[model samples]
Target: MKKETLFIAFSTQKGGMGKTALTVLMASQLHYTKGYHIGIVDCDYPQHSIGEMRKRDTDLVMKDEYFKLQAYRQFSTLGIKAYPIKECTADKAIDMAEELMQTSDKDFDIIFFDLPGTLNSPGVILTLASMDYVFTPVSADRVVLESTLQYATMLNDNLIVPQKGNLKGLYLFWNMVDGREKTPLYKAYEKVIAELRLNMLKTILPDSKRFRREVSDQRKSVFRSTLLPADKTLLKGSNIEELANEICQTIKLENHGNQ
Candidate 1:
């Protein structure tokens, strides 16, 4: 049998939902912690945030001796390879994924796509529909909630239900959660979840100043930053380990059933 690769996308029709951050966090955790071979496709047209961040990361690693040393140690110790970030337009995304899976020397075991935060982007639908799973980050705010629900409904109507097996799963996870204590927004989120019957992941990431400022200035992720290890951080910290584990288990279960 041919090798199997898990294709996942962090996408939504709404912006400012931390889609790129979540994608980087999950990819970092899986690659550094779980030792999975992975690559990211930055498909957000006009503004490839992940690709830009990767470039910044590379520049930092090369420019700073301390970061270079620490990064080398981290990668060598974990036996993890540097994965490529491919900049793809929406029209070429599916083809790019196929090429990566079939021909890329890395032979990535998992591929993550950071798609445009809109529905009208060219080939967005085609690219998203080809993925094995699409996870949308949703906030408790009313505008975000409404857009997320509408986006999910659109996917279901246009691709999932109508095409049957085109998209394996569509998942939603609460992002930027406030705290452990139940708040009004939390309650509203619960109500929305019930109303839309959202298939939400159990792992919810908390709001953190670190995540908010990570991309532009620091260009580092909390989970897999060369500047800081997993143990050290000022922010509330990321729960990406739990999220990664849950996703892995789910994927395994799905693959087993398919067999």
Candidate 2:
């Protein structure tokens, strides 16, 4: 029997939303920590960061003895695969996704898209509309929150609502949340969240140097990194685990055993 594959994208209309990093983080956590078969489709056009990161990761594992051992234990026995990144035009996104989702016993159970952060790109609308779910990460900045809400509304009105229950959905989650107490920005966000009735996720990723220090000029996600001090290590691991679990529950994917 052909297994079902889940197609999801970490996307937003505005740039600087950490969409690419989120994709890599989610893919790594779900595959390495949670034992799911995962792959990434790098469709970020001119600069395919995730694709480049995959190459860098492969090289580090091969050449650096310490990195290799750490990565090997983290990955353990499950296979983690990444398809070659493509410079796919928006017009070709659907075809490319369909090609990637051809399921078999050895195929990926989940495939993530690292899309360019714009709707103007060719086929972007069509490609985004075709996803099983689109997960948009937004910060507390007024401009970003407003734009994200507008984009979410557009997706529902244009793609999901009119499709007569094709079951596609859009989700919003807070990214880069700071540790400060109830600030005006967060209060404003809560107001909008309630007003829009958006499918807000429960996982809020706190602002941390772990995300920045590890991701900068490197291919290692925190999910596969072994160099963190004890405190940051525990915090990062907890956050990643909670976020991964929330995602799986939201998407209704069974925690298939170590495949």
Enumerate residue pairs that collide in model 2.
90-122, 90-123, 91-123
**Candidate 1 clashing pairs?**
none
lDDT of 1 by residue, 14-116 (tens): 8888888778877766666566677788888888888887777778778876667767887677545566678889889878888877777655667898888
Segments of candidate 1 deviating more than 4 angstroms = 180-188, 213-237, 253-259
Instruction: Write candidate 2's Cα lDDT for 137-247 as tens digits.
Output: 888878888899999888878888888333378888888887784667676787787787678887888876566444223444344322211233644534756777888
Among these predictions, the greatest TM-score belongs to: 1
Using all chains and alpha carbons, the TM-scores for the candidates as numbered come to: 0.85, 0.84
